[model samples]
Target chain A: MATFDSENAAHLHRELHSHLPSDPALRVKTLESLAIERGLVAPQTVDAWVEAYSEHIGPKRGAQVVARAWLDADFHARLLEDAAEAIKDLGFQGSATGHLKAVANTDRQHNMVVCTLCSCYPFSILGMSPSWYKSAEYRARAVREPRQVLSEFGVALADDVAVRVWDSTAELRYLVVPQRPAGTQGWSEEALAAIVTRNSMIGTQRDLPLEAS
Target chain B: MDAIHDLGGMQGFGPIPIATGDKDFAALADWEKRMWGLARSGVAQGVTIDWFRHGLERMVPSDYLSFAYFNKWCANYLMLMLDHGSITLEDVKRGHLLAKEAEAAPKSIDDVLASNAQANISFEGACDTPPAFAAGDAVRTLRIPPPGAHTRLPRYARGVEGRILAHHGAHAVPERGAEGKKDYQALYTVAFSAADLWGPEADPRDDVTLDLWEAYLVPA
Candidate 1:
């Protein structure tokens, strides 16, 4: 039996379907057109959702939450206690965030989140999941070999710092509250948020940049 | 269903293609954006997330492995619309030429926005019974039979003992939700040490946590 190689599977699919309208773009167009024509969905509805995610919603919401958590001690405590409710304190709540949990990175421990079964991310807060996050390689390895995966993402952790990998198996989503960077004291909330990268909240990156961009 | 989608703890995949700078943050392609919008619209039209995931899980393993993320989503959306009797095979085959005049009133963009905004899939609800296990209770996951259908229990965690880290109140069960049934059960965050799951090869200091329903567990 020949060994299966997932990396080449896409190429193999294209080779097999060389003569067909094998493009996914065509399929999406057909589906959208049919859906709209059948009154199943509005064309503007499609565009609205696209605009909502791409333009309005993204990592900035999560960054604001992280920045607030760093500055407000009460909010930080509430965020750790109940992230879903705490986020609403800042008016950040939506789908995929109802059962949220905020796990903070500390001196002794680090946290990361992955959805091994499909890409279950906190899209309402963190926006659409990153391509690397949704990749098969991440879903396959993040749970068993998290240290190695983090290393691949350029996040090296001390051996003593325990890694807590959250596998989003159910409805609940996670937001990893990375530790505030050093020398970032007395910074404004907006200034603090500017330094918090999307990957940092996802736990693929640690050590936020000190200088606000 | 013991499908390729349950990729946790699997091996032999290459390094993650971590794109540099803002390239990883590039805007979605036009088709990808349309696919995502269509998915949200479907959800607003009553397709549960669990049902959508189940449909994806039912895809042929080879195709599931080969297709891109949005490509798989596009395929699943078509299957769902077909199953829902909203579209026909002939319509899909003929592409844009099959488009018919819509008979229903078109929803405004604001309506769409509001509908989607309120379409939160939070399963959190009150449970009739108290939670069987509390935080710090030792428990073992049930080893469900093969050919499982739309279960949140991953293969790697089955038959393994772990301690409950937190009880997350009652939430709608995905397994039942996939079947168009609404059932609530107490959910807990279960913590398993890396040493227990992967043996000596794993770092002793590390651990993994999974949100599991009460039914999947019993006293260890």
Candidate 2:
């Protein structure tokens, strides 16, 4: 696990904190202390919430959904038809995914998801959004120059393959079902899921590696 | 408020960070984790998600632009706590609880989980009113400024003509929900061609789809 040293975090540490003169780390401590002191929330509850998102809920859930869809035509159809309801079959439907929509990748069309208004994502299924997905650069350029953005993510789609960018402007969240990698026939769902990278499900990576990582 | 938070289609930021896969939630600094937990716990305690977002949107443009994502969240949490009279500025400055008598009974882990679960029930629901547009209908998003400070309509999508790809049954309308009203409206996935939104220079084959409330659209 890496520390919070992303460019945005570094920029905030250097620039914003200098001007504000109050450390966000200290402020968070104060807030947590206050919350605990006020009996509004317990320390165990906070730890539990963190554990649930960090360990229990994440892209692994989305990967299982994708892997299942790839193996089961009926589940795939249901996923594309009503993802919110379909995910319930695997007990993966919850917050941030109550109104889920699944967009599949094909030779003709590529799908990507972004939230221009804010960092809206299917957190319940895909876990916390990557730092880049929440960055201003992604949110702004994704809708206007998706091909360029996709290329930056190393996914260079051919000119004819249409790109569809889904801006989550409402409660409805999206899950991009990346095209299954070829030559992986007769693979177990677990094996397939192991190779389903989070970025692939987020539509940044178009192709999955053949072997589980 | 049309603010810096609505970042669709504007320019001059920079390239997105390289794809390194999703970061582990546990990788976050302890303070960041606490910030996340506090914000979610705050939502569990009745600070509606809409309200929390509205608070973030209300941030000063400079702060909204400069602060890290969780930093903005921390600021919003403090602002909401202040608004809810749960904390005082002095208490924040002092770094501890100043009003001990005001403390409510501490919530157990189970209580917090239950509350969060209750707060996060599926937003999908049956709509009493029928959808005004069908899947194949052509519609133009309303160009007018939103009636409230919070709206899901991005500046780029407004006034653009798009085809309804699908109708998502009624969901909480953010404009009304931001103000603490329980309002549901028909939402649709409207697909706008790149040529339509970004002009002819953009590839005609590509399109952007947005799940927009009916209130943000009109029949073309």
Best candidate per lDDT, number? 1
Model 2 has a DockQ score of 0.36
Assess the local accuracy of residue B161 in candidate 2 as a C-alpha lDDT between 0 and 100: 98
lDDT of 1 by residue, A81-160 (tens): 98988987766687788788899999899999999999999887888788788888889899999999999888888767
* Backbone clashes, each candidate: 0, 1
Q: State which candidate has the highest DockQ.
A: 1
Could you give the CAPRI-style class of model 1?
acceptable
Give the distance in Å from residue A209's predicted Cα in candidate 2 to where it truly belongs: 1.3
**Candidate 1 runs further than 4 Å off:** A1-20, B20-26, B43-45, B96-117, B145-148
**lDDT measured at residue A168 in model 2 versus the true structure, 0 to 100:** 89
Q: Candidate 2: lDDT of A204?
A: 88
Q: Per-residue lDDT tens digits of candidate 2, residues A39-65?
A: 787777777778777777788999999
